[model samples]
Target: MNRSNGGAPHRSITAGTDFLHLAIEEAPGGGKSDWLASRIRLALADGRLPMGSRLPATRVLAGELGVSRGVVTEAYQRLIEDGHLAGRGRNGTIVVGAPAAAPKSPARTAPPLPRSVFAAAPGTDVFDTMRTARARIDLSPGLPDLAAFPRAAWLRTERHVLDHLAASDLGYGDPRGTPALRRAIANWIARNRGIRADPDEVLIVAGTAQTLTLLGRVLRDDGITAVAVEDPGSLGARQHLHNCRLATPPVAVDSEGIRVDELRATGEAAVLLTPAHQFPTGVVLRGSRRSELTRWAREGGGLIIEDDYDAEHRYDRTPVPALRSVLTENVAYAGSVSKLLAPALRIGWVLAPPRYRDALVDAKRFTDLGNAALPQLVLAHFMESGAMERQLRHLRRHHRHRRDAMIKAIGTHLPSAIVHGAAAGLHLTITFDAEFADTELAAMALARDVKVHPLSWHSQRAHRPGLVLGYAASTPSDIGEGVETLGEVLRRGGAGPGFVR
Candidate 1:
């Protein structure tokens, strides 16, 4: 058989007699395994079975062909050795990497909520739409352990806040978020991030999205319309900037961090960055990049809108100092308890340069009259009572376990793939070498009920295909199973590595 070039046509048999016609009978216990392997090779070559087509289990096919299980096993082993088939954990044996044009048998489709679902409208409720999209399994990123949310602790705090709540306290509180929360956040940042800020500079807003919206409006009003962003950055952040009618100029990011020279070249008045640990790539903005960016900020008369997202989950490296701590005036620093505590709290802090502080506070004042008061106060109590820090410690241990599991699973199943950004944060970026689209692979994965963010979604420039998988919210077994399913999909030519689905 010519393995490199296309072979002859597949044998088209109607039913039982056809399989029997191709089947070789064991004679005097001669080499059944070698015979079976030869038959399989011919079948694969002639297109009798296609790529991604699931083979019958070893014992079942052995019984049907009236052969010993070892004969079937040996045949499978030979094909596996030749890179035609793979053992897909619980997914069973599947043909993975086959020639795109050389195929025969058809297969079932993913249940529903197809890949088109991700392209839905980007409005106020887009996130809700995404969360509700049904899949066989959900691997959406940026979620904490919803199952581990401190229900008892929350109830106790809620009751305490309500008991102490006077009728007047329920009315409109400070537009700069609740004083209690601002003070709490100030203290928290001082202790954890090494940034000391007057509570006056800390304006509470609704998570990072609102922080972007408010900043976008305030910056635009200040005659700054474009903000440079890191290449292969957060898709959600880019969308938020676009939603506020702001241009996001793309800046290249390298090993150290966002290219400061490129940022200066763009001449954009402001830039948004995830410098602590960059989004998909996971590289921290090291000393050189930090110093370069600081100098650029001082020289360019620009602003750095820092999205200090998920800075608390470092494993292999020491925690890097926040940009706000380094150049407080130039960096409009924002952070939330979303990754640390929960996103549902809808509470985040922003430290703006003195020039934009009043306008940002005004935007917050008009934007839903500031974030709700009770959650802010309860979070304050949580921070003061040490529950927040305790929760972070708990998440660190849990997330570390999941991250290790995912790395191990990738090593075993998809050894060809390179893993990035596994040291910190809840997700890891995995890239592979193939001509096929990653989006198509993601679509196939979705069809199989596994959801992953296509790396293309985060990149504005041409780049390699990959997936950003979050490990924080899921259990270790779930992470392994999800990645295994992805491996099976890749092998089957449902989608090739490096191609966007």
Candidate 2:
């Protein structure tokens, strides 16, 4: 049995002493310490240094390798200094969590399992499984600053709301959410998003996901089979629409924004858009395009589903008012606190056109009977008390700094890349003019343990090779490290060519 003294494996002397199986080279005469460090780094890069894995003591490893203890000590010290390893008092040296391990090619004894969205007896937890799939560092878009969640403020609000509520109020409130939340939402839209809405016009639902689901049901019932979506737009949104059985026609988006000309050509009854800050590409609808789209909505009698996502988190530009604020009758407007607050809250309000208001409320009533009452009351308190606005002010400063860090890192690491939509929002879309497939690159990135959304993943129509990276949830250091790792991945010609499975 090996007596692990915390640094190295206390096994019998073998021909190999490192992860790369680097045999001692007598011809080189020295530099074993450097070789040891390199081997450890490679092991880490390839995921051999899994989280919480104990390392053999320096003395034990030195004895096994027939080398001095100083060599192993120096090598281990380097990793410790680099945040890759941590020393546990009596427990010894341990590998802390890092990126995921690269996939190893399947051998004859172990064939790789096939992956698909639809398989018989599908995995019980698809969402959790997808999240667990390897990535070196995740650059996925849309995540907010999770670490900065206003826990204290939320607790205070919860306590305040609970204190005032009577026991009778707990026994199932209105299905359209608490009337208080609807009134507060009305005030919120009028103040922040520029939409002058009445409390009765507001129908509270879960987040935008439920909004799309209900809208899908209502539109389908009304015989509207297709809703045109911006090309290279939100994949999650498109998938949600598809899940609701609504056919999504891919419409092209240019610098000014989604091609209204192409949209008109489709002759669809309705269109879903991220007009304030378009997703994935980050291009705002220009003056001309906005006018043209409004004209199309007016003349063609097509309804517009304006998802004013990420409109409140702007920096370096004046706020753009929601299109619904301009033409309330033609637009079905929706906004959620998912990005602003937390998606876990599942609290948002929708303002449908007069014709669809009652239908949407009915749809919401039948399907979950309104969001939780207490939470809605608390949220109402949050908005009416102006706590939500203060929180936004705090996030703006924090998010701006994080965004700048990511941009600077990209400049320093991947100079060939172009950043999109840095003027506002919690994430940035970066594209590279490389001679490689974004999907393969994304898979390779995942193989290397960094998570990112391939630009192609969002595109129904063709788009350039790129990745959508979210900086809001990560520290500046993590963003820099993640981008640097991505640069290394690119420099190495995809994700470590031969080592990946």
Report, for every candidate in turn, its global Cα lDDT versus the true structure: 0.77, 0.78
On TM-score, the leading prediction is 2
What's the count of clashing pairs in each model shown? Answer: 14, 14
Candidate 1 is scored at a TM of 0.75
Q: Model 2, range 386-439, lDDT digits (tens) per residue? A: 899999998898789889989999999889999999999988998977656665
Candidate 1 lDDT over residue span 1-501, tens digit each: 112113232222224215534455543367877777666656666666676556677877777777778878987886664446666555556664332233244453424454544444434465435545555446666877665576657777878888887897789888998888889999999998999899888999888888999999998888888889999898889889998889888998888899998998997889999998899889899898888888988987779999997788888876788999979879999998888777887778899998899999888888788778888888899898888888888778768877898899899878888999887998898887765566667777877667888777678887787888887766555677789999988788733333334
- Best by the lDDT measure: 2
lDDT of 2 at 273: 95
TM-score, cand. 2: 0.75
